[model samples]
Target: MTDSTAPRVAIVTGASGGIGRAVAERLAADGVRVVAHYSGNADAAAEVVAAITAGEGEAIAVGGDVADEAAMAALFDAAEQRFGGVDVLVHTAGIMPLGPIAELDLETFDRIQRVNVRGTFVVDQLAARRMRSGGAIINFSTSVTRLQMPTYGAYAASKGAVEAMTLILARELRGRDITVNAVAPGPTATPLFFAGKPQEVVDRIASLNPMERLGTPEDIAEVAAFLAGPGRWVNGQVLYANGGAA
Candidate 1:
């Protein structure tokens, strides 16, 4: 069991930008020491660390491809070495390639599965093995799994695997006292979501939700913070943070 008095520590993958960055900042603000993981953007990762430090929160930038098991092992090592132990893991690292299922090549499909599904399994397996009791494991999924949008077939399939793993892992953890859950965010205003999308298309998608606006990274971060903190009872569930778009 973790010492409740000690400051909690978290490793947030994909912390270079978007929802991951927001979640890292929010958890740091809540007195958790953050290991901000990034894949390619060292400069952006440093900026996130700087932001956390500027706010008088503790954070460090760690770079590694999410799908690489060795790199991920090192990431967990850095967290344990620096913060004593890991209390939470928020895996927001993934790739989303929007293409019609009919035309999506096998290569593209494999790449998505490798990064999204395999990466989650690698990270969560490590977390499950290493996290102390009273820990939380949060995985990222997409609201599109529920939305069932046409071009989202491949991406949604990857997330469906994530949802499946999340539920089973929660049960597998039985006596560990760790909560496992997936957060499925709707169209958030992130660079990834905006890429290759026209303003008109963005507007139309935003209007599908009753809230009538794209969810912000900070909006998703708030939900993540809840799960990693006081949401111990919310295990084995997928929380759709979609603003009712589906």
Candidate 2:
């Protein structure tokens, strides 16, 4: 069991941007030491670390491909070396290149699986091995899996595998007192969500939900903060943070 008084350590993968950045900042704000992991954006990762430090929060930037086992293992090492031990793992690292199932190229599908599926597996494996007993593992999924939207088949499929892993891992950690869950965000207002999307398409998707506006990275971060801290009982499930889109 972790010492409740000690600051918890968290590794937020993909912390350079989007929901990952929000989650990293939020956790740090809540007094958790953060390992901000980025795959290719060292400058952006530094910016994340800077913002956290500027806010009087503890954070460090680490760069690695999430699918690479050796790199991810080193990330855990750094967190342990810097913050004592890890207590939370928010795995928001993933890629979403939209294409219709029938027309999508095989290369794109493979890339999605490599980053979204295998990347998740590698990170979660390390977390399971290294996290303290009273920790949590939060994986990123998407409401697209439930929305049945066209052109989202490949991305949704990758997240479906994530959902499966989240459930089984929760059960697998029965005696460890750690919680595992996935957060499925819908139509979030992130650079990734806006890329290649026309205003009309974006408006149409936003309107599908009752809120009429798109979800923000902070909105998803709120749910992540809950799971990472007080929401201990919400295990083995995928909480849809989509503003009732599905």
Candidate 3:
């Protein structure tokens, strides 16, 4: 058991880049020891860990497929062995493949669901069973579920499953003092969002938000930090971190 006075520990999946990287850095800045989980980018993951260490914060990189049950279990074990125990799990590991449901290939749809839906279940299940009390589990969703934009059918469906699972898991952990929630971001300026899009299309989407700009990974990271720290009263909610888009 972790001493009450000890700093909290967190496992941030997909921490190799984008929102996950931002979240891991932010949490470490806030004095939380972080287990940075990456899928395949060892170099990128190591860079994140180096930055954290240079800043005098604690972090380690762990790589694995988020949907793999054994891998996820080992992730949890590593956090426990390294930092005493996990108090927060920010599951930012997912893929976004856009396609219309009518024409989307089954292979693509399956891959998206595997990473987004099954991945959430695998990681969250481990967190729920292993984390100390006062834990916070933040999953990722997308505002596309609300926007219902064309070509986002498969991605939105996967996130919808995420939102549903988040709510149910929160209730199921009743009285555990653990908060379960999801963060749904819209039109973020990440590499993932810019892929295959022209500048004009990107500009159009950015203008749709009331903020009149794309959300930075840091913007979304702020929400994750809050949920993992002082936002204990907030539970079973999907906090949309978009700049008022949708």
lDDT by residue (208-236, candidate 2, tens digit) is 98999899999999999999999998999
Q: When superposed on Cα atoms, how far off is each prediction in RMSD?
A: 0.7, 0.7, 0.8
Error of 2 at 173 (Å): 0.2
TM-score for each of the candidates: 0.99, 0.99, 0.99
Give me the overall lDDT of model 3: 0.95
Ranking by lDDT: 1, 2, 3
Better of 1 and 3 by lDDT: 1
Q: Write the per-residue lDDT of candidate 1 for residues 24-128, one digit (tens) a residue.
A: 999999999999999999999999999999999999999998889999999999999998989999999999998899999989999999999999999999999
